[model samples]
Target chain A: MVPTNIKNFDTLVVGGGIAGLQAALDLGDQGYKVAIVEKDASIGGKMIRLSKVFPTLDCASCITTPKMSAASHHENITLFTYCDLTSLNHEGQGIKALITQKPRYVDPIKCIGCRQCEYICPVHVSDAEQGDFSARKAISIPFSTAIPQLPILDVEHCMLCGQCEKTCPTHAIDYFQKPEEFIIQAKTAVITTGFDLLPVKNNFQYGNGHIPNVIDSMQMERILAPHGPYNRVLRPSDGMEPDSIAYVQCAGSRDKSMGVPYCSRVCCMYAIKQAMLLSGSLPLADIIIYYMDIRAFGKGYEQFYQNAKAMGIEFVKAKVARIDKGENGSAIVRYENQDGSGIATADHDLVVLSMGMIPGWDPRSICPVSKDSDQFITSIKPKISPVLTNMAGLFVAGVAAGPKDIVDTITESGSAAMEAAKFMSNSHMEN
Target chain B: MKNPDNDKEKEAKKAAMKTLRAQRKDLIASASSRMKTQKKDIKAIKEFLKGKKATIPDIAEGIDMPKDETLWYIATMKKYGQIVEAEKEGAFFNYSLNEPEKTQEKEEV
Candidate 1:
């Protein structure tokens, strides 16, 4: 049986990624009570996992950590991590959200955030947070810098070793923990649900992710991250420092067969951004980007793309058709060079697929919100007010509305918060 | 925080732990077995590539293991500095043992 607890807030921000965090912070600063519901154990979201943001190439953590810390420490904001929203519907003048907080097994209050229990655990599992290039203990915190500093015991992989229980200073390890149901009431809501990269498994042209050296952009981000698994750029197939790397643009987006016809907007720039970073790390290695079009459509973005070329990064005008396993463990890229070279094939030590972005959440069954043809939450008045959703008192922001970069996502989040705040104040006046 | 009534809750937790331990014996054993096999695979792959450069498929066929599974082992070996990347042939890059820099020779592709 799940215990139900009721709470009230001025605004509810779904998805605790960058956009949600920014929205919550903006409302919280204005003295409005806000609730941030995150599906993961930590609150940093996808931005925290990123190595660096494009254009500036600044450390992503340096920018996101302070915001995460502020949100966690804010008086008006409460974080509900590792939770699932069962239903969200309009209740009278407010919104009622049914949330199920999945058990962490370890009591949040009693646990000291010490990693002693993790060290004693025997089971080892692939750490997806690190792009699965490394292993982590089954009973451990998501990362060293994970907000809330809580450890989650992976019940599926845990062997019920009493080692963690015995090692804990405070008997916080509770194996029988169950989910708790909670009801949150908010005058308005902001859907900042983020975007997810298209899966590489079913794409037959990309060798079905079987060619070991062929990785996705997210994996490339991990490889470039300072605190990443290996802490350096190395091919996953055999840990060899790659001498030549290729980026396949439009690999997952703008395809009729895969059902994603949109450009995904950010792939081209990110590919170039990563190529530049790779140049810094592997000075002698040849970095090439196979792109149909280089869309540097942001402030200082065109120059950033040109800067990469100046740094000797090659941008080949080609559409990658298929990837095959090469003789020695390299990835063979087959493509047609758009520069009048009918058909071409190239071998590179590693290939990174710039997969397109897809809407992170589908709210068909959960809420009354409608999605656009591209599957992102529909914003009825995108030109007049981009944050206004079709439903009243509900706003959508960031990539949840459409694919965008971090800069645009953060700006959109502020707009959403302001709109939500105004909606709540107007409702208060009417009452 | 310690009280006489708290003893009951502690006892319940102990019983739960004991039952869980009993149920998870096979899980623990299997985990150890998987680790052992992974270690053996890493060793075998390193030995096979001791003085030769080979692609993932070549190593997979040589070690009599599936291509997908062999990739994992080869990645682990590379992570630990047992292997280094060689030149690209056709579509794949050949991998060779990580030898001293002085003895290394650039392979002409």
Candidate 2:
């Protein structure tokens, strides 16, 4: 239900990802009332799923959780997770937004994340926590370290057995719970919805999106991660010991022949990181990487790449022409060698693609105001400012603004916050 | 006691910025002094930074330049051995005039 008080917030941030969280934090720190509306059950967004960020080599949760916790706990910021903006009406003074907070069937304020309901939950579902490499209890925290510590019931898989509802310590579970709709009043809104990974084709000749051995770059990160499914590297298809791995760069980027033509900036280093981490797992495992160019331009990133090569990770300087699933469950990679000699094939037990960033929003919607060829929001003006978008009160940051490293993303996000606040201040003064 | 490291960081950032602006100023001045360096260019920046050496980012407040047509013009100069890359100290890059002999290329051109 819409709050009867209808508190007039100074700014409303949509999407609740890193960009929105940073924007809200900056505004809130300036003593402005801010609201972050998140479609997910919690914030952190895509960054949460990442194993580790580049350059600094920090854990994703270590860097992001503080911001998430701050956003949730801030007195000046109200976090509405599991929510989406349904409708928006301009109030002349500000925007009147209707938000739908989908019921997790758990009262957020009272329920401590004690995991009582999960123990009794009868249903089993794919654990998005494990990147769907494993299953999880229906009533479960998104992960062990999720901010707000609230659990979400997998409503689709739930049988409404009501066993979990009966067992809750705080009586927080309610199967009949309806989505609470509310109106938010804010002078400006920012979209920080974050991004989704592209689906790999089943027909990929590379070991497998189809075969167990072929993994996406994200999955490789997870496997190499200390927190990933199976602390040891195990080929899921047969659970047999497989030796070799190959990383194919520009899996879906910079190829107009396919849909995406722009470079995925994060892929080069991430592939290297994955390769290095994989080497740590199998000291004897032969690792090979194929690429257009090793763009390790970020600070310390070049060092990381060199470290990988020094650790015996084979760096093949060639664009992979194709992959053929070979006999004995191995895959063959055919590519021209660096010296442009005769093309040769190399066999591998697994293949990993270094996929690039793709925006979640359709191009036609957020265009003209912030349009560009790469589908990211163009900076407000070409050279004057780097973070501001065309929309007066709104700003873009991170990959949403344009391709950038993690430090650049945060830096731009901070600048966007200042720009948004200045826009608010000037508008308020004008009013 | 003052944190000398912080002070040095602030100083380096300013110097790098000054060097960059001075180079850009040369670009705009070369293009058309009558048009005036747009608020966004390096020449306007040097004028803005006159006498102030160590300004914090919060303190470095002024309107930025609008575009880089003049800056791009200098990029052509870079290709033809006119402009050169200065030492990269940290986050910022510094640019400066070479020796008088190199600067005299404009006279011949």
**lDDT for each residue of candidate 1 in A257-369, tens digit (9 for 90 to 100):** 87789999999888988999999998999999999999999999999998999999999999888999997679899999999978999999999999989998999889998
**Would candidate 1 be rated incorrect, acceptable, medium or high by CAPRI criteria?**
incorrect
| CAPRI-style grade of the A/B interface in model 2 | incorrect
User: After superposition, which runs of candidate 2 have C-alpha atoms over 4 Å from their true positions?
Assistant: A1-7, A87-93, A202-208, A240-242, A327-329, A363-369, B1-109
TM-score of 1: 0.87
Report the number of the highest-DockQ candidate.
1
Those runs of model 1 whose alpha carbons end farther than 4 Å from true positions after fitting are: A1-3, B1-11, B18-109
Report the C-alpha lDDT of model 2 over A127-231, residue by residue, as the tens digit.
655555554666788776676688887655554556776788887875545677778888876656555555677225343365546678877766666666544
For model 1 the local lDDT of residue B58 reads 89
Q: Kindly list the interface RMSD, in angstroms, of each predicted candidate in the order they appear.
A: 5.0, 29.9
